[model samples]
Target chain A: MRNTWPGAGGSCLAESITRRSRLLAAVVGLGVLVVGGGCGRAPESTPEGGGKRLTIGVNFETLQTEYWVAGFEAIRSELKKRGIDVVDSIADGDSSRQLQQIRTFITRKVDGIIFVPKDARTCIPAIKAANEAGIPVVLFNRPAAETEGVRSVAIVADNRKLTRETVSFMVEQARQSGRKHKAMVVVGDLGDANAIGRRDGFYDAVKGNEEVVEVVSEVPSEWNQEKARSGVVNGLQAHPDISFIFTSSDFLFPAIVAALKSANKYHKVGTPGHVILGGFDGDATAYQMLEEGYLDATGVQDVYFEAEQSVQAVLDLLAGKEVPALILDPGFVIHQGNLHDLKDRMWGARVMGR
Target chain B: MAIGMRVDGWLPGWLKRGVLSDHLILWLSVAYVLGMAPWATGFVSVSNAQTILAYLLPVLVVSVGLTLVLIIGGIDLSVTSIIALASVLGAKVMSGEDGWMAGNALAVPVGVLVMLAVGLGLGAVNGFTVAVCRIPAFIATLTTMMFVSGFAIWVTLSRKIGGLPAGFVMLGQNLWVATVMAVAVTWLAHGFLSRTLYGRWFYAVGQNARAALVSGVPVGRVTFWTYVASGGFAGLSAILFTAGLETGNPEMARDNLLDVVGAVVIGGTSLYGGRGRVLGTVFGVLFLALVDNSLNLVGLTFYTITMVKGGVILGAALLDTARTRILARTG
Candidate 1:
């Protein structure tokens, strides 16, 4: 917001013009230097070696969360099984960064490109760019907007169905207990489609049961542990008698547990005065908690399977095979009872995340 | 003149003095908190106060060093990155991953040492770039900021590192301990700046580098060391922050640069430097914390809270400017 005077720093008008031009020249020079520094030689275009030895560029929305990290790890390991090499970069939730990386991948002429977009709309440009470069792009988890020349195959779990099943299970548990249900529904960022879908799913499940199951509090966490912790603390303080708490994801369970511990209200299943903990993103850590009876149920995204499927779709596309525009992989619910059976199927079950 | 003069029967000399200029903002904040007590639920409670203090501690610690840097006519934009870098390194050593210090009892002390050392070393880089290379402070520190931030991501691979020892974690959890540490550090800084000869060099150099050089003051050394000290404080803040969160996140202190700078400026520190106090920075920290806590207690919407906070800060700055003019006219 600070303005620079044209001739204040110089004595004469001509001198000022010269100074300004020099400054502009220096800035352009710096820009060129930076771009020049970033350049690398792209490997020569080679024929696909029986579809075995191919290089794939993978762009992640972010590796800030363990879920994404584990998902990427699964995709890499699965692709490695087929002797495929992955070159991955984290966008850190920046759309421009994601776009830039995709452009870099296109420049490098990687055999195939995989994108996990931070925002669906902002990913359109990147997808279009990849398409122009004749690179088959696969959208993992978050799909981009519909656009011409951007026919990217989308691989995502059914978020709405996932939450619906998880909440339906919670509703049944509340009914079996015969207690008036008081629930605190912790939503993630509304800007995120999954968060919106999950919130809608929970509300849809509880539509006709207002008398039996009351929504006491609804907090927006933006998928942050600290904010979620604060929300839980405030919610519990406001409604101490609430019977259940539903988090948008299992990633936030640590924050929920911390808040519960501070309030002296953390309890296991079957314990008197227990505040039932339910979450989405059926991570292995959450599964372990379910086995320990600390958690009740969660919606399982099965990130590993999703990863495996996404890589397969990219491979198929590379091999001139046709793939659907919208490949649906509906997730399921894992409660305390079935957690053991389903835990092994989860990528989260194998890797412990923060 | 009377030893203790008063304009009004109830208003003492000290009270009158405290209600002017820098101290005016502090008193206003206290009054604001108390005035909102009746309307805001639990705003005046001990538990709420501790929660507020816990959040305020790290920023306050960092502000002490920043205040010094500002007083010497320099700003370290890399303070936040230094925090991230120090925290990630500390967490890596203490994580007990791959037997590198391995969550042992000594790990806590070792982690603390690593954080401080890394902070100092990085700060020295900033100092060297500015003092030795003769680069402008802003551009020099900005360059360091980028590298340090990238280094942090490289260290942690952008992943959040947890598994800290319980003993170290306890330091961040106990509000009393954090509060005491913050106050002690602030008090020491205040004493050094006000009472020590070397500390006086900061003001002399900031006010006029050429004059200070003529007076045999090593202006470059003073400038360099201030940045190093700022880096050290940033490191200390990182430790406190990580201990509190029980995790090392590259994004933890990303938004704190504004808060630290704001605290120093609001504490009556001039942008051109040469005039400020650690005590004023302490007041500034408390004032902002009070405003934030009060706004939250009243359950204001996030956008409304942000607008109100901005307005309040602007109002304070305006009042200070008006007061200066009034004093000049009267004198």
Candidate 2:
């Protein structure tokens, strides 16, 4: 279902649009050359009178999600604060469009590029295009499929560590309640490296405790709410003895809650037979669920921090400063005790005004 | 006629007639479910049936419109975007404390109407472009699809719109009601396409638009109204989808265009346009849902599930081609 995950563009329509857009870009490029006498700079790049401004092209996978939109906004706003000229393009979840945009960025002769890839594997050509153009490319949140020929710095939250911490909290809660941890694991699209790493982290934590901590079902929901709900219903029917629930992303919280309620297994922290719910992607929804005592914990991936660091990385590259090839920002775990304090710190609260 | 008998020698006359041009998919769907019984758990159970039905409802509903447009020799790529637009509009009306219809009983009905109107408006645009403006169906609908999807994103600012009224949410969450609605809608579409003069015109236009015009069939009106119905149903589906998820997602059916087109084409509808039926689409959707459900039950990975779906669509298209040729040769 990764092929149909959140922000994945329409297949036929996107390919067709990309063909047309590429031709249009060529026409626009010719016009720019005629008007500016091959200035090799976007009109948005204004001279600040102090020094030459650095123009960075930011490519987003799809601006359809609050997370990506917020992250992009943070990056743009932060860069603007530092007087950096920004030009952005949205791929709408099509990797081909993303690759094409990279070429457009290269043609525009931007100083650097920031890419949020739809599929890590489909981004190699995009990274290569930037490298061939001698523009520094910064991979944000998602890594490129093949980094061998691509000279880029990847700034992503450590999803595996986040999931391990969240899953560990769920296990600890189950053990404290003296309940055998018969858990149902709802996974996101395995096509996403972050999702796979999170799932691996869950298994890593419960590795040798198979006797006490049992994984009754593993649902690959691909981060779809309806599919996740259906999976939960089917899983509950197949394994009614399940005592805990773990989700790879907090976006599945609604589906998990609905399914749990339907099965009459949803309850507060102290209630008997209550299904201890733990999730990843600490957003406003997860915090709300946590404050309500429905969700036990969530590992927060600091998307704002990821954006800030990505902007900084691209700037460093443009400045000819040494930066790490991979910058790992392992996020924190949030529970009831810290939910109140971290409510405003979440990405949703900051950008979405949730 | 000869091919039908050759394919199923032991079948009764009525079933043989069904197995050739139209009902071939229904029989195949039945056999598929029965065959997969051994490997998948609860394939024949009531709960499993409910799951399959619920999963197919939105696609089935939208396919009715697709079937109509396809019958008239046109395609609507904007249906998926229409669903998202309608869902967001409906959710917007009913969300928040000062929201238009937050807690009122009329909120649900009004929300439903607004969704339908939005869908109809978008559909009419596609119809106008294809029929009146004479743009290629592919380019026209594709443009609308991108525009509508982009507008929806702008309206919601790419955020999830939720807190819908409880009554409105029930349209999708209530399994029994949604099932009944799907069946009823399918029956109505079948009746409309078979019993009405407009239905005759649908086939006439699809068969040959110029010839249909010579015979005094208002090709433009028929094509326009067909798109209107398609968009209206997409709106209806938005209500169901939003209700089911209890949230308005701009990407609600971003990937469903293929599913709808596949079901329609698999149901024996010619992609080049003209001959097809809603009854066949009913089985087509069921066939797809069964494949997906059974594969999931058997613990097959998503990659494998996707391959199976693609293979099924290809086989169905081939069967459709074969049936058309056989009928042409026999006649």
Candidate 3:
């Protein structure tokens, strides 16, 4: 009776099973191919000299942004010139994965480790593991939590101070416009230390300039362009008189531009009704906008400087020299006035083939 | 009499006739809009309406297809990933910056085709795994979601591609164009579900695959095509989002998955399958869009808005359960 049914017939059943077997084979074959391709890269050989070449393990939070990509490339190229081998892994924003990668590096007995943590506090265990393993660790571009026992060398930009300078530049521009201004601050993910520091910096710069700049809206972007666009549109609708805008990062410039253009307010700096714009991360978009007279200022993090410092710290640690617990890159604010002179120093410009 | 029957008996004739019970979300949405207008600045303005519509269109387009998948007792977690992959691939075809057909007049059409192709292709992969391999839809779609997302990021090196030709971008810029597209898609989907024989097969397959097969329905074919249709819808949504943002972003629509799924479920769609309506999904999307816009205008923090929206979805779900029980008893 079952075999007599439409889908339950013997021929149909046989064909179904055959098709399922074929699909299983295909899926398994594809998986093997992917895994094989991922493992194809060979490790670097020893240098020409007779001396044993040092191997360093570099762990990254994510390379999704141009800033992180530039930093990673700078570190790799710099280490390559000195004949050092680097084994790197990216956690892709998973703190637990970052810890596991660090442990793997410790197991491999790498001479040193440089890692950008996903979270300030969750990374303490990774640092502790490296410390116990007697491997020198360098925190690259992101500082770990201020724990009592865990120790590591941190090389990062002064995020708050740099953002304060950047926002102050915008405040000055608003002051010079000779009228009180409504402002919007596009805040990043609050969980990130750098984002919090930048938010504080905006507040710090706007503290005494209340008469010139009144912040009417704080659009929480959460580091996503879609969220940034939506928040900016809603903020603009609520407060259409907004004449000043600052984003936590430069990657969101595209979202801001779209929102402003939709509202017919995306004008150049000198144009009437132009909104004073400022951003951090000094990415390629910010550089182009500043050059085109649409952006007022951007906080430049000096990726090359940070990368060089991180590599130096690792090398110094390997030499039995005591490196500073904290290495600060006092980043500068790049604006239209200084853009021409500092174009060569800006990593964004460098990435743009300038 | 049962408690549900007693409750139904006190209601007005229209209420007892199942109008309110069937379209509860619609009434709740209307009440929300009227109630929020007084408190949220610009909540009733034309400009705010445009803003809400812009935000609503992409989510609506994606949810319309998701409604079908849910109706057939399947779920596709790869819809957002499809949007991202399609957005970037399509942008690569039509972008003014070193695009394949950069200066060509057919750039927009070709780009649209590529985006749809990516969506359909990925959807086909998902369908084959689930229908042919007999794998669970959840696991198959989840695997596709992860791989497609990673592939998209790899394709662009995590960089957003800009310089999309103005002609392609104009589709996103014009509100009327987006509205027409969304409405046409929704109307067609609604008709297919309400007035077609194949659509009836989807419900039968979802309700009981064995029974559907006994009734001479091609269960595997129906399941396969439902996922393909979903993929096509997600691809169409990618075109709107890419054009609207004026860039091909690998992370496009990454945060909208929860919204799409939540909206569908909140609109009285049964997660266990065999029951849903396209009209219900529309009201669900509208309700979410309204809440999001009003909260943003009121200057509430993102966290606060998220909490409020979660509460509203929970309330809607609870109301759906009560309404179902009451209707079953009264009938």
Point to the candidate with the largest lDDT: 3
- Per-residue lDDT of A208-317 in model 1, one digit per residue for the tens? 87766899999878778898999989998999877888888889889988988888888889898787778888776686788788888888887877888888898899
Highest-TM-score candidate: 3
What is the per-residue lDDT of model 2 for residues A1-354, given as tens digits with 9 covering 90 to 100?
Answer: 000111112222233545455424432332222222222222222335457788777878876556676778888887898887776766656443344456545544577888887656556656755776678889888775443556788988798888888888878887787657788899976666777889899998787766668998998786678889999999999998888889988888888889888999989888787788898877667767776787888888788788889988987887799998889878888888777788777765554454
The alpha-carbon deviation from the true structure for residue A279 of candidate 1, after best TM-score superposition, in angstroms, is: 0.9
Docking class of 2: incorrect
**TM, every model:** 0.51, 0.51, 0.52
RMSD list, candidates in order: 24.5, 24.3, 25.3
- Report the backbone clash tally of model 1: 1
Fraction of reference contacts reproduced per prediction? Answer: 0.00, 0.00, 0.00
Give the clashing residue pairs of candidate 2, or none: none
lDDT (C-alpha, whole model) for all candidates: 0.74, 0.74, 0.80
In angstroms, the error of model 2 at B89 is 0.7
lDDT, candidate 3, residue A295? 97
